[model samples]
Target: MPVILPTSIINILSNLFCILINISLFYLYTFKIFYSFQENEISISLQIIGIIVNFQEILLRFFVGYYDKGEIIQDKQLILLNTLNFNFFYDLFYLATLILSQIIMYNQKNSSNLVVYFLNLIYFLKAISVNKILNKVDQLLYITAKADYIYQLLKLIFKLIIICHIVAVAWHLLAQIETNYFEKNNTWLHDLNLVDSQWYSRYIESFYWSTTTIIILAGPKGSNNIEIIFQSVIMFATMGTFAYTMNCIGVILDEQNRKQKEYKRDLEIINIYMRKNNLKKSLQQKVSNFLEYLYQEKGDIQVNKNSIEVLNKLPQNLKDDINVEINSKIIQKFKLISTNFSQKIIQEVIPFIQEECFLPNEIIYKHYQYDNLAIYWISKGKVQIEHQQENAKIVLVKVLEKGDCFSEYQFFTGKQHEYQTRSADFTTIYKIQRDKFIQTIQKYADDYEYFNMIKDQLIFRNGSIYTNIQCLICKSRYHRENECEQIHINKNKQLTILKHLRNQIQISRKPFFRKCFYFIKTIQLIKSCELCVNQIKNNQELFNLIKYIDINNNSMDLDQSLSDNYIQDKVIKNRDNSNSSLSSTSIENNVNDICKQTLKNFKNSIIINSEQINSNDNFKHSQGNKNQLEIKKELQNINLLTCIIFINIQIKRQTDQQLKKQAQIQIRIQKKQIFKNQSIQKKKKKFLQKKNLKQENPQKKYNYLFKIKQTKKNTQVIITQQKKKLVI
Candidate 1:
């Protein structure tokens, strides 16, 4: 049977294998002690293993998926393209060098040290592959174990160890160069008397010297300027390393103790607040106990506050699922909800189920209290339902344990509580407020109707429920009967004469006939006032009199004339013969005669005035005809100027009309083009639909095609009609 390893296991194994190969190659290259082995078998074997590891890693890059941002990219082509980039070339070069060096050593039997050094350098570059191992290890530590402080501490320690190892290797390499290349006798190896030491001893001495100098700044004396310079450089690098290590340790310790510190600070703040408020000892003790219990129940985080923020950040579906999971137990407590509702309806209400904790013997509500009317379900501990008797003594009604609900009757009926509720023990309750629950269920019409029906049935079975008395004026349940009396008083105060006039004016302004009627009434009022009549005459207001007469004639005509004649005759007769009135026929005749005589006299006066003006103008003309010619010439010039202006206005009007017509024609053409495009799109969609129908249902294919042809005929008719209209 073939073993199929999981992706995580495969990744871990590959990372470990790469780390082992890199470390082994690093050690062999650094020490070079295996060079003394027969035929250099150990070194050759290590190099071969490294070449194999590198080749496999490069191959895996083409097959294995990689993470880009947060998403895993598993496309084979993408993997191959990415593998051919910079890392691929570097790996290929390293592999070729290893192979070449191995061949040279095998062929020569005694290859130059340069080839080995070159191989060492190439392997040193391969050390960067250990990053993959560190990354996987980091994921295991921080994600799997969820110990950030531990991961950070391990990271800092690993970095320090790598730095120490590199420094040790560099120190030994420098010593080798000084002694072997420069032929010097005053190197660090000579000073320590380790020139003839075993490979292990030399390595131990170099590591010890590097660690002491980097960490404590104390080691064996340097015998040359080159050694001193190297020590100084190491000292400077050590300063930075030490600073970084201290900072990492500080952060790790702080993270480990953060929760404890927060808890202590909160406890101290609560105590200080209690002391500042001068609260009673028993009350303070109760508060402290509740705080302690809260911490024990919810741990370091404030679950209610933090959970609300977390739930808000989550998607709607996830939030709904979480709410249902946490509060599904309390859902069965409600009779209406459990019997009449489905799981879907219950899920809608779950989001509004808020969890609250109560201390032992704490009063959740009192008898007859109108506020805090919510249905409560006991999820943990017990609740004591109490009632107040006629004698004002509290009686225990019942003890409601887990899965029991209370206050549901008051919530549905909008009534005050009949009995008080107190916690018998440290209880946890899931409460759903009446308003929120009603609003949420209202979104689903069927659910809301069924809920209402079920609520009514439940209320009927539970005996009489108190209903609020609604006010008659405002039609609100919250207003008292006495408060309605003030509305009547305010209405009466607002209905004064000025207010009535304003309302009539506003009404008159709304309609044409009302406005005309109002204008006629105002004219009648002005006619009745003698002072207004005199003012009109003095102002040459004949047009006002004529307009008033024309309006009266249009409305009343003959009756208005008869009334005026009768009134005038009555007034004249009264002056001539006291306590006497004239007949209607005589009054009408007398008024007509008086009007004719006045007209004749006015005509004679106008004729006489015209003759006098003509006589005066002829006398002036005899005195100077030259002045008359100059006046005629000035009049001709004024007439010509007026004619030119009128012609220019006519030309401008013609141009404006032509431009307006052109704009209208362009707009109509653009609209027709848009309609054509829309029609074409519709025809294409219909044809596509017919093709799809032909594949799905062969029988419907002919029907769909006929429909499409009918639609095309109708569209063509519409286009032709539109074109004829545009031409017209």
Candidate 2:
């Protein structure tokens, strides 16, 4: 059976332990040398340990409702509350200190107060430490452990009383245990069980001796008696009970931690497994299914360990840190493992004959360089090995475009070169350094255990050169991020990533797609689905293309028309570029024509939806402004509304709460005033009657019934007035 105990019992035990430490300190100091810190290795070690003790003190205060300065002062309560990261190490250090002081004093020479303080400190440390260990062990089982912190606190005072009793017992026991070493051992009282029969003994020493006999109960060892057997039985029972309790606590804590680990693993596995699977499920169906599951199936399954011990291999932590080992195990055991990085790396390094380009009349390799010791892979265009002799023909080696590895037979045989390597025109090929090539074929290179498999493959060095991959502008503009900060280009947007380029500048003026894409990609994340690159043909096509894109998915809600002010600015800026300047009337007519053409196309497209158009009432929209202006307005409003709503909600809640509290306070004050007024009226009526009677006859008033002015309760007011008058 479990040793079930209330918080009150635990509190009693805790405070008893605290008193034990403090009392031991005081007793040792009085009997032995007055204690001082060594100021050497022991002291430094203690100080280092003391820092942790201070932190533990802070932690205890926090748990005991001492958070603020005022709370700390007000807190008479002590609590054994388990919290984040207990100071076990600090408690151990304090225990070590208490034990050391006691041991040293027993060996050496003592003052009464110092010994008492020492004992008290020792008892305090023990009680607190015991409380913590039990508290933490209980909470690990998810039990409610706080109880009533204040009540437990008051119980601590009784623990000090218990400590005082225990310490006197320990002090006498120590003196008896070391009787041979003591100089004053021949005292008459030492031989007598002075307090055994006499509770009325005059000496305090008798009380100490009797208490020690009860706690330790040491008598002649071999002399058996029923009383001695009963004492031993009690001691044995306590030992058995504590051991059993600790054992049970340990088992529950282990199971709880294991379940937590398994649950975390299951959550991660579900996320990883579902991500790809969730994508294929239709969005509308997935959302519906998810909602249904949340309401119906959420509690059906419990969290399990994601990874199984089907194969008794590496632990999860090791597998995670060293992925190669896990991947190897997965591939060998399962036949295939889908790892994105492995797939990407294999694509990069797979041996193949690949592509190359050649300019006219450039040499691929010269005659002198073509020794039989090495091979050349003519992976691409027009390879010719030329003779070193004067006016020699540059013979075209088999023009290996692709899927071609050359000179393998000659390379391994160490034969003299039949031909030299040069370009028929200009050519490129992957050349394998023979020695290095041989070294690479020695195992997985990384898989040191499998060196034999690579030995034969090393002889034929297959090599190729492929065109390095590049980004192309197809729909979305491709741009390098580095170019966005060019001094001549716009710097209006310090944050280059999210700012819409077209909104800031004209289509022609904005950075090219190649530059912008890379720029934005660096600053902000571009989801793969969102990126579609399109190259510009010229100004007109670029403008028309830029115009139609509801590219900023957030921009489906704009008036895709040019404004009058924008048109006027455009006319003024472009007046010099065109053959002739237009009058204001001409410009307005041209703008009108432009608006008609732009609006006609814009109205036909369903890209600009109605919902985003009417989102803001304060911002005016027009038919002539381009779609970019509308995107600008919507984004601006989004920011402003977000800020306004945030501030408004915070202020409104605080004001409402404040007003509620004030109304309650006012109501309370009014009620109090009303009661006081009623009492005062009754008193005033009584006083008037007494005055009227006194006037009718000679005054006859009872002394106890006479009024005393409330203000006259404190005479300090008269003193303050007198001081002020004297100063004046």
Per-candidate Cα lDDT values, in order, are: 0.67, 0.41
| TM-score of each model, paired residue for residue | 0.43, 0.18
Of candidate 1, the 10-residue stretch with the lowest lDDT total is 576-585
Q: What is the lDDT of candidate 2?
A: 0.41
TM-score of 1: 0.43
Error of 2 at 329 (Å): 28
Candidate 1: segments with Cα more than 4 A from true spot: 1-117, 128-136, 254-299, 302-728
lDDT by residue (493-591, candidate 1, tens digit) is 556756766744344455445344434377654554554345336533333433543443353335334544534454445452232122323433443
Best by lDDT: 1
Residue 80 CA error for candidate 1 (Å)?
6.3
- List candidate 2 segments past 4 Å from native: 1-52, 59-129, 133-233, 239-243, 246-728
